[model samples]
Target: MGESGAYRRLPVAERRRQLLVAALDLFSHRPPEQVSIDDIASAAGASRPLVYRYFPGGRQQIYEAALRSAAEQLTACFTEPPAGTPTQRLRNALDRYLAFVADHDAGFSALVRGGCVTETSRTTAIIDEVRRAAAEQVFVHLGVPAPGLMLRMAVRSWIAAVETVSLIWLDEGRQPPADQLRDWLIDHFVAVLTATAAGDPQSSEVLSGFLAAVEGQPRSVR
Candidate 1:
């Protein structure tokens, strides 16, 4: 085959990934409702029939697939190795997450806020899975194999705060800089953990560890 011809025959996985990337790009810039298969095909340098061939369920299938792909990536943002203090580790994780929000502003907003016509039960579940996965990671970072009620609630609350603040940051045109947002979020997490610690022994232990880890690092981090 000629060099040009070689470029036309991607493996099945590569072709699907290419299409999903294109679709995600579109979804990130515009609402999912505004995106079309033709637009995805054009963006991917593939034909409409080709898109259908891979995704027989059509646009809805492609949208769901793209969302699943995005969810996987988002979930990974919180699963970093537990190498640093809880605050430092969370800062690193939040950096990745906020970067994702900034990169996929429109799509992130739509996914979190819902109300998209193409949304389905499966899509909603997938999005929820990301939140659960994130909260689990936070617990893992705290070294809590089995978190108590208050500790669990505190972690989940922080996760929800991160999502809410991310959406608001996007709406506000990403103001105050991403670092500032990340720091503020870390503070919020500390506050939530501290509040929970007062009433829960498990949370008190975790909070002590977190405080010791950040001790003498910097006032801002404290």
Candidate 2:
């Protein structure tokens, strides 16, 4: 039983996590600006005072915590085993990323779009950290020990595009299926990397490696 129906008090961490899970659930389906402490308390089956006990700053405090937790999850989306080719790893990563977007829905939208009532600099930093972490993971998959400016720009731009496309996918009701979107995104990454290679020798070298690895793989007929 949850704290709401419990006669005995939970340990401090359990209580806090229960409350945080409740907050994240509400945030997942709706904008954080629309979520409140009362909503979380109701969802968690706890009282307002108890939520306040755990998060004295109320909704703002809890929202940041939820965002941080979600950020970590999103950042981990780019991580994959190095066993596959770079594009294969990237496709796997995109599947995970898009799955997260589909799972989070409105929360993912709010997390990237920002401009929420309770959003703070800390929240913004958390989101940015996800972006940077994602880019770094892209570099890792490309086996680039030091990504040049052009390669960095290409990867970051692709990340931003992924975010944009994810929002569009949600708005369109997840049409085209996630696997289709994932394959298309992988193609886009290769294209962007190819374009970057035109100007940067480092990108050219990286692109050569990626293409060599992807040469024999089956790709979408486009």
**lDDT of every predicted structure (CA atoms):** 0.86, 0.85
lDDT of 1 by residue, 1-222 (tens): 122454467888998898999999999888889999999988987788888888999889999999999998888888787676677788899999999899999989988899998888999999889998998888877777788889889998888888998888999989879999999999999999999999998899888878877884432111
Q: How close is candidate 2 to the true structure, as a TM-score?
A: 0.93
| Candidate 1 stretches greater than 4 Å from native | 1-8, 216-222
Give the clashing pairs for model 1.
none
Clashing pairs in 2: none
Per-residue lDDT of candidate 2, residues 1-222 (tens digit): 244446236888988888888898899999987998889988988888888888999888999998888888888887798776777788888888888899899998887787878677898888889999999988877778788788899999999999899999999999779999988988898899899899899988888888877886532211
- Lowest lDDT 10-residue stretch of candidate 2: 1-10
lDDT of 2 at 36: 80
